[model samples]
Target: MKAVVITSPGGPDVLQLQQVNDPQIKDDEVLIKVAATAVNRADTNQRQGKYPPPKGASEHLGLECSGTIEAVGSRVSRWKIGDQVCALLSGGGYAEKVAVPAAQVFPVPDGISLTDAAAFPEVACTVWSTIFMTSRLSPGESLLVHGGSSGIGTFAIQIAKHLGIRVLITAGSEEKLAACRDLGADVCINYKSEDFVARVKEETDGKGVDVILDCLGASYFQRNLDSLNFDGRLFIIGLMGGAKAEMNLPTLFAKRLTVQAAGLRYRTPENKAAIVKEVEKNVWPAIAAGKVKPIVSKVFPFSVAAEAHKLIESSQHIGKILLVPS
Candidate 1:
């Protein structure tokens, strides 16, 4: 088994490809021969020694992978050996093989290729959990997504559009805004040139958005509060800008807003299983029907995972980036 290991993380250059022991599968787990993995911000953070793996998780950097089941545990029944699947992992996705809890795997849709499926699990689960499960965003309501050209943002915009919600996205450039617009964003605000709160207000004709998927934590704290309508819910999935913004109590008191932050990897196995199940049942069908698909930015071999990390860290990719286990 080959995997990318971070030897005292500092930069992408620190990632070393090495042959390691294959993971041993538990009775409740499955052994997957990984085909591809997606590069995530979490992976870059881990490489830079910022984000550490959860307790008992593998030290490898990847968070999600698409692969074929080489073997199934005794307790597994829903799948068999050679079944194609994509899995959401707490870690260890940057490897040739991974032993994962069977509950965390989902069958790839018919139209989705094995490599492309690697991009689905993380963003799909993140968007579904934050927008539908946590925030409870409903049809006809307005939703704002920060980092609109990001992997999660692209999926969020498409999902919101499919659910009949008004979508607003914030990006730093015209190119990013245009990408988001093409993905069905109703309003795109160049955060570099315009105040998103004001633009959101003007677009909504005064009422703020009903829900916001925010990645810029402390920096957008006050603005996020101000951009919410009465009883609005804000779901924080990442703290990209920084994590110490001040809150306005008066604004919260007046609008009765709810603020919640969640990390998909920190969730319990059962919770992730539930999310995977739901995504399979509700989201996979749409993907099979060609109603939804992730926009792929690029693909790189597993040996050059560092290059993938560098690309994502540049924050210039318009969509998901895939890394094949070559």
Candidate 2:
């Protein structure tokens, strides 16, 4: 199999295409012939040696993929060869083939293209797991998402809207904020031009948001706390801005806030399966109905995986940047 391997700890240029042995299928796994994969922050981090794959995970640098099942393990019953599917991977998605637990895979809906399905798993699974599974965001409540035009943010905004939640988002620029508004964000704050804490308070009539989905980590930590309602759940999915910051203990105590940080890859197989189950039940229906959809910003050939990494690093895209494995 051919895969994008990290030649050394460095920039996107470190991602090298190399011939590697095909992953062997286990009794409960499926071997998929990958069609496409999406660039993620984790991938870039892993390429740069800042993040490494979890123990026993593939050393290849991809977090999610969509493909056709080429073979299934003897114990796998839910999927078979030739099934079009998209999956959240623990790692190793940037390859010609991957063997994953059957429980982590879900069928692509009818009429959805394979490449588009590739765009779904990472962001959809991330947002669904964080907001619905972790935070338990309910209808009519307000949810704020940072990096509003991002793959996860765009999906979060759409899902929050579809579920009847009030959505607020903050992006670096007005153009990105406008994109978030188009995706159904009720309030789009230009973090550059406006103070998000003030804008959020104004929009929610001083109540603040019920939840916050953040990836900015340290840079937004103080403001994120200030922008949340009492008992608000703040799920931090990345450390894009920085990793270290001081927190106001009094503010956290007074608000009774919940601050969480996690990555999908480090989750247990059971946890990932549970997230997949939730996505299959609640989010899949929305996808089938065209209510929630993957937002794809661009597509690059598999050979240009390095350039794709640059795009994600620049935060220039409105949604996912896809790599079609050829």
Candidate 3:
């Protein structure tokens, strides 16, 4: 099988497509003949040698993919050969074939194309596990999402709006802000020109949002705390803005806030399986009903995996970018 290989710790140019051994499946895993894989910020980080795949995971770049099941292990019962499915992968989605735990695979939602289904698993599981599952963002509450035009942000806005949550988002440009509004964001603030903390407070009548999903870690940490309501929950999933930050302990004490940081790639298989199950149960219905949809910005063939990485790093695309096997 051909897979994108990171030749060194550097820029997108480091990614090269080359022949590699096809991944082997364990007794509880399935082998997916990759139809499509989505590019993510983490993939770029991995290419730069900042984030390595978890122990025992595939060395390839992709974190999620949609494909046909070519083979299923004896321990896998829910899926069969020839099932069209998308899966949440720990790594290795960049290859033509990947081995994944059967429990992380999902049936493509009705009305969604098999290729587009590749965009859902990672963003869906990330948002669902962090905001809804851990933060307990319920209906009738207000939520703020950073990088509003991103894959995670786009999906978060639609799902939160569908569940009756008022959505506010921060993006870098007017075009990005407009896209977020069209996707059900009630408040769109340009992080480049405006103060998001002030805008968040203004939109919430000075009380602040009930929850905040932030990817810019240290740079936005204090501001994020100031933008949260009493008893607010803040979930940090990425550290794009650097990782070190000094927090004001008084703020936490005064507001009774909760701050947490987690990612899906390093989680135990059982934990990922549980999150995948919850996503299938709660989020899939919204997608099937046409309330939530995949937002694909572009698609690149596997031969141009380097270009896909470049596009994601440029941050010019508004949603997920996909790569199909060449």
Candidate 4:
């Protein structure tokens, strides 16, 4: 088997494609011959030695992949050999083969190719868990997603709109803002030029948003608190801005807000499996019906995974970036 390994904690240049032994599967796991995998910010952080995979997880740079089942473990009854599937993984996606728990694998949704399916799991689970399940965002309630043009942001907008939620989002450029608006975002704030808190407040006539899905941790912390309506929930899944920030207890108490920060990579397998199952149930129908779809920014050959990492670091892409095995 061939996989991308981080030679050192640094930049994209540290990634090296090296031959490694084939993975041995547990009784509840399946061996997948990977067709494609997608990039995420976590992959970059791993390369830079910032975020480490959970104990006993693959130490590779990918978090999700779409693949074909080459072999199934004895205890795996839900899937069989040759089943085409997409999986939410805890690492080791940047490879030709990966052994994954059967519970975390899902049948590719209708109207999607195996290659494109690689981009779905991580973002789907993250957005669904944070915005819908955790925050309980409902129809007619306004929700704000930071990084509106990102892979998660793009998926969040479509899903929220499909569920009849009013979506407000922030992006870095007009080009990105236009792209998000086309995806059904009610208000698109250019974070580079405008104050998103003000934009969101004005859009809601000072009522503030019911939910905020944030990626910039501390950098936007105070402002995020200020932008939420009473009883609003703010979920943070990424910390691109910085990890530590001061919180305003006065604003928090006054707004009656809930603030939470979370990540998927370190979650227990059972926890991840539950999230995957719910995503397959709740989000899949919309995808199967063509009401929602993945936005792929680019696809690169897996042998050049380093190039893919470079692109992700550049942060110029509007949606998911996929890496296909060469």
Task: Compare the candidates by TM-score and give the number of the best one.
Answer: 3
Q: Model 1: how far is 148 from its true place, Å?
A: 0.7
Local distance difference test, candidate 4: 0.91
Query: Where does model 1 exceed 4 Å of error?
Result: none
> Across residues 1-326, which tens digit of lDDT does each residue of candidate 3 receive?
99999999999888888999999999999999999999999999999998999999999999999999999998999999999999999999999999999999999999999999999999999999999999999999999999999999999999999999999999999999999999999999999999988888888889999999999999999999999999999999999998999999999999999999999899999999999999999999999999999999999999999899989989999999999999
Runs with alpha carbons beyond 4 Å of true place in candidate 4: none
Mind giving the per-residue lDDT tens digits that candidate 1 earns over 220-318?
988998999999999988888798887879898898999999999988988999998888887888788776786899999878888988999999899
Where is model 1 poorest over a 10-residue stretch in terms of lDDT?
A: 285-294
Q: How far is candidate 4 from the true structure (C-alpha RMSD, Å)?
A: 0.8
- Residue-level lDDT tens digits of model 2 in 26-77: 9999999999988988888888888888898888878889999999999999
Each model's lDDT: 0.90, 0.89, 0.96, 0.91
Superior candidate under TM-score, 1 versus 2: 1
Best by lDDT: 3
Q: After superposition, how far is residue 261 of candidate 3 from its true place, in Å?
A: 0.9
Greater lDDT among 3 and 4 belongs to 3
lDDT by residue for model 4 over 1-326, one digit each (tens)?
88888989998888888898888899999999999999999989888898899899888778999999999999999999999999999988999999999999999999999999998999999998888888899998999999999999999999999999999999988889999999999899988899887888888889899999999999999999899999999999988899899987999889789998788988888899999989999999999998888899999987788899888788899999999877
